[model samples]
Target: MPRRHVKLHARPPQEVQGEAVDVLVRRGLDDLRRELDVPPSFPPDVLAEAADVVRRGPSGSRVDATDVPFVTIDPEGSKDLDQAVHIGRLGDGFRVQYAIADVAAWVQAGGAIDDEARRRVETLYAPDGRTPLHPPSLSEGAASLLPDQVAPALLWTIDLDAAGAPVQVGVHRASVRSRSQLTYTGAQAAIDDGSAGETLQLLREVGLLRQAAERARGGITLPTPEQVVEQGADGVWTLGSRATLPVEEWNAQISLLTGMCAARLMLDGKVGILRTLPDADPRDVQRLRLSAHALGVPWPDGATPGDVIRDLDAANPRHAALLTDATSLLRGAAYVAFDGELPAFTMHAAIAAPYAHTTAPLRRLVDRFVGETCLALSAGTPVPDWVRDALPELPGLMSAGDKHAAELERGCLDLVEAALLTGREGQVFEGAIVDVRADRDEGVVQLRDPAVRGRIEGAGLPLGEDVRVRVVEASVPQRTVRFALADDQADSASA
Candidate 1:
């Protein structure tokens, strides 16, 4: 397994001083698309076929489960709803029914929609918009698990014992109607104000149980604050960091639970695609310990990396920097597809579990096939020929999409930061030294006020210490920002 370096997004700057950032980000995104050869739109025939599929509606055999009060929880304005969940207490245990969009039901094998989806692999997101893998008519319309609308879904009914570990897992195709569409904020408020209905409350309970189980299994959870681009009242784009809500984690646990169950199914059934990550290198862990010491974060004696990381505060700049640098430990994530023999490696290091992605078929390409595999295995039927043939090709296709997604995210952030600091070159700003190069000639500094991260050319700068820096360059076209230590700060460091 190869190592994968995952970069964390910084919080938005306090104030953005310049023109609206939307135009610049839009242009940069277009350039990135061209450079990556990302498909601009679905082929016209694919769209027409999607429309025809929508009219034809769900076909073949499926269990009717519209009575289940499943609900969707996503970002405030998300249209491409993927998974809807229903939870209930069963005696001393729990039952979770997760419904994933039945994309395979609508997309025929080797058809126009299927061909285009195979090419795109996954949805590519930008600040201004997104390039979807499937036509919106299916991804967001007929196939989406919107409220009160019956839609085709791959349903997973998982029975968990009191310890939150799955005791039984069942998967099948079904017609499901979401009772309502809820957002993270709304769900959190409901949980806080005692307005949360039975399902939401049960979801919280099961989510926490699963979270505890994850930790007990030595899983690593990094509560890194997200840098988000938002529009102000005047329509100017600004970057800011948003803290992850408890509800978000709780909701995510449901997905993780389903994924783990799916992985076990595949391992037992002898064929499927899995999201796998190798364990962190011992050298990386030692380096992280040294970093924690320098950053004044406590890594108590005999503590595992996961234990120490689970307690860090995301709001603290030093801790955030440590998390950013910790990306070095979480590399080599890849999709492994198998037919008869199980892959030599099966566990995802971060999750500390054998995991398969079966919950977000609408957004991801591999999940579609994983869902199909689970359904077939549960029914004691053979895996579809299309899905079996696709196993070998999915890893490469998904890898390409992963690279494009990362580039789009990081590139947009770089463009926004450069735009925000265009006229502020040569101005001194306070920042923290988040990272240092081995050569000691330069390091990565994160500005305190504007929340901009850029390279600084300075020697002997202490990691995790604050210093005054002068912005030497900011170029929007190149999406680069360079800084140098202020005169007094440089002199003091040298001394």
Candidate 2:
């Protein structure tokens, strides 16, 4: 991956003119309030009451969690801890001990908490903070995999062979005692410094092997920049890059592996929604191929586009650029639910597998239903009526949540970037060429450092990743930052 550099100059926050951030906020709040019908309070008793109801439900099996060495890996200060994983060597493969918080264990079928959870549908993240799907008292406290706390969970042990293929999977309900709470950054640092504990080392190893396997399977590895907004002492918003460590990616890979297995089961039974995206169109592939060739990147002949992507992403900066640029081709995602048989297009282009959202039940409502169903099926228990009822509505609800969340996150980013750029209006700053449009009328120039991009002139200038440019204008009110040629106007005229 290409390294990103930053040039920082300290300055106070300025009022961004022209943009109505309040309108965006209002719209976001309205979506949460009106569309989701989010509950007003984060009460502890709600979860406790729900758990009591589930406890009384008829089931021949028992669930516990106090013995398993489950641990959570999330961002520092994250309240809604969703998952805890443990991995170890098993034969020539590895045993992945993943403990996902059992939201279904607590939230009763057709209860108030369940209704509220369904209403929220998904968690909302804003510049200020997050509106968690579950109350903090349960999500952050009781059910969370806090150190030494025994919590009810759905435990999955997946055995992956040395080649990183999952050979076997075991699912059960249990009470787990988390040894400690680990942050992704902390775990990554330990792996880097070679002083990581046994558990963390296993995590790093598993993640590495899984990543290698995915690459071998022709999965697209794109370098996409993520923006995070942090509040300052003066209540000003500042933009920062969100670093995704190898371990984080690996952790996600494990989640994908589990979801894929669950999806396979659902499909074999010929029912349930699977997260699906069609393979890239041939024209898009051709365009990508030509672009890579134009950039002097190696495009492997006689191989699939995925093969070209893998080889290029591994070769040169041009190839890396090519890989990232192809991200826009993957779109028009659909929630596929069928009973007769699985559809031909159930594959997710990114992971190269049929997958579903099944692991993050605490954070996502759809996951709760899917997770519960998976658990019941795995345990040979009858699928709950509420879960059966929930399966159909989840596709639409989750998709709507995805749209709403994306808008809020992107909107907040625009506002913050606009606010940050106000401090440097008419000031020249270095940037990279992220994208170019054939129309010339529509183009975005992304910066490499201080990393903000914008629509800019593109008549003759080549727009490729990491190509340098300069900021020409910054508007907070308009929620836009403009760029121009970095060289002197005299030099430009002479040229």
Candidate 3:
């Protein structure tokens, strides 16, 4: 899986340049987008339809609920807002009202915009820009959950009991206005300083309760810190990393709560799609235990992988190695659609629940269909035939989009790593072996200073141990970086 990085790799020219080497980085990313067959622009007909829809305005059937003091949270500078939330405390419980962008409201079932979105599958992100599933006129404009905009949305009111488990759930179309838009950093700062409003404070209380509940339920969330590739004020590309903020997880819980509810609704209605991952193989689990023991991380008796992972800090070298290795179990995620028959495998290994993607309809294609399906299920209305028709094709489309996104992202990151190391061939750097292949002759070495990971060549490279490695190769065009044990050269000379 390609890790999600905070990329400054948006549109080129004056913005991306940090100097001369930055030019190479920019070119490499462009090559990657082309290689992935990413569509550069929306079709003319689709653009026209999106513009027409924007002019016509949102659905008139939406109920008035703009008085709800909703707020949006996301990365800084994000414009394609999808979900807005308002949380208030109930008697010994919490009430969460989440408003999801009603993409289906603006997109007619068989229109050109719909057909184009189907062909595109989902949004694709790169360092330069995003290939949006819907044009900006809709995704970032009319259909967005921008603050104070009074947009049409599918409003979900979920009431959770004292233990953070859902006690009641209902969803309907409504006209919503977000009171404010906040970034994770901004929200966390407010809460930490004790200056947050009722919603932010309640978010902290409810989020902690939900996190505790997740741990209690053996849910797995491998929040492996992202390798951030950024450009400094000097226009120089720099590589660093940061862990997911506490607020991010809490906000994500709200989305996950809605998705779980959506999955429940579809399951009861016997017609919907799901985001599923099979349980990890027992042998892999046992192997991970051995890895943990080798890395000096103690695994308590009868502790689930999620339990151990929850306590392991990604900042620690030993813990990071284990987290890197544990990613193997998170593979095989897929989309499953059903009309009458329920799929046996519905649990998302990470979420540890029957989950669906219902919150991010702007960026993800399936969430629109899911939101529509769940709405019909909640309203006791028939599932739209168009949604039913799109279900089977969704898996392939999403899978392809996921593949392209992962490939493009990984390629871009690799290019940066290679370019950053290009002039330092043969230089020794301190790094820890975070992962080793089954053969034990090669492994992944994460550098301490630059925060880059690359293949290390050697026999029996010690996992989790700090070692010095000499860069053997850095190819910008190839998007590769390879290192060899510094001792390899010493051993040869001594012999």
Candidate 4:
């Protein structure tokens, strides 16, 4: 397997996340993976089939779209490319040509590769490495929408009016060649310095327009920075956060538009799975407002949670805490499959619209299926029997995969915290209470110096206030790092 290098997002960087740099940290990661039953490599048969599929190449008459000059944008050194884009003028509207990697071209359904992908469900990432959904030969090579590589793709032609509202959308299989692969910082620099081509300049225009449309629809987009651990030249590991550049968010708008478009197609057919999240419970939003009030964070009257959160800065400790805890509002996300009758609910609250996961097929299992559903529905053909039969179970597999991925992320973070705080037990640290559980004498804390977040055991824990606490326990072997209120301050905390 090719070495996996993935940047992972965690709690807005108010936590300790490990990227193995030393022998001890590396061994601890290995042990942690074993405890979680994470697969280290693909099966022999799966790899053999992947290589054979790549050798045979795409096996259909694909629409030649290489002249469109699409380009891919992702993190630096990224290989598992998934989506590419090119924007052009279309009278009073814009023509957005987005090409997503067509993984179905190489990964035969029910074959060894597909079966293995089903088990994996989605790509699992850590600060150190990742467990990819497909073998690298497909994910990073042939099926990846890499620059200068003519690969099969699901090309989407979405026409958007001047206001960024979609007027028409269509997707079909095609052969595409990305003209360039750009990193976020590089792309943003080009746009800022007036060195960008028409495609990139149009992306900025379309991205801003779409953002306004999202706000009008009461949507919230959380562009969380990734947590990273770097080893210095002297071999000392230090952890930090990678603040996302503007280009990343702009690039993401295109994906979001495509997802919303795909969902429209699936909903029209009424026979596909949707990535759904009902509107946030009103009680949850009220709770957030109360917390913000206690923390002295301003909440203007008539402003929604999305508005308040949009104005927050992660660099502020109080804002960081609020943002971390605010994730609760976006909970209860799950997949819903419908046949003839539409489900009772279908809105993805955060997006404020019907949405499906239709991009990143190389990394996510559901996207491939969603792509197929939209393709068949668009072509006015019968949905494949295999696809129809699998819809019922896809939700369960994806839900399980979501839970497992969360566990893996938390375990890795705990290991890093435990290792970083070795020999620091019984020491007091300054931190802030991010969340308070009314039913229990405990909440969540974000430490000051190391920026670690963990469970806190204390009474009268004020929400979003800085306080001093002692590290009651830090056990590397158990992969645990815990904190408790100091003896003198146990009952003294106030809102």
Q: Which number leads on lDDT? A: 3
Tens digit per residue, CA lDDT, model 3, 210-304: 88878887898886888777776566777777677788888998888899999999999999999998888889899999999999999999999
- Which has the higher TM-score value, candidate number 3 or candidate number 4? 3
Return the TM-score for each candidate structure.
0.94, 0.85, 0.94, 0.91
The C-alpha stretches of model 2 lying farther than 4 A from their native spots are 1-10, 14-61, 233-236, 302-324, 465-478, 486-495
> Model 4 segments beyond 4 Å from truth?
1-21, 223-226, 229-235, 427-430, 485-495
**Candidate 2 least-lDDT 10 residues:** 1-10
| Model 1 lowest lDDT segment of ten | 1-10
Candidates ranked by lDDT = 3, 1, 4, 2
Per-residue lDDT of 1-495 in model 4, one digit per residue for the tens?
011123323322222334333555667778988887889999999999998998999766789999989988898889999999999999988999999999888988889999998899999987677899999999999999999999999999999998989999898999999999988878989999999999899999998888888888999865444456554454454455556666767788899999999999989999898999978788989988987887778999999898888877665667766887788799899999998889999899999999999988999899999998888888899887878888999999999988889888877777777666666788898887777786888888877656567789877887767788899777767887779887667757643
The candidate with the higher lDDT, 1 or 3, is 3
Inter-residue clash pairs, candidate 3: 9-127, 9-128, 10-127, 10-128, 18-235, 18-236
Assess each prediction's global lDDT (C-alpha) against the native. Answer: 0.86, 0.68, 0.86, 0.83
List where candidate 3 sits over 4 angstroms from the true fold.
Answer: 1-19, 438-440, 488-495
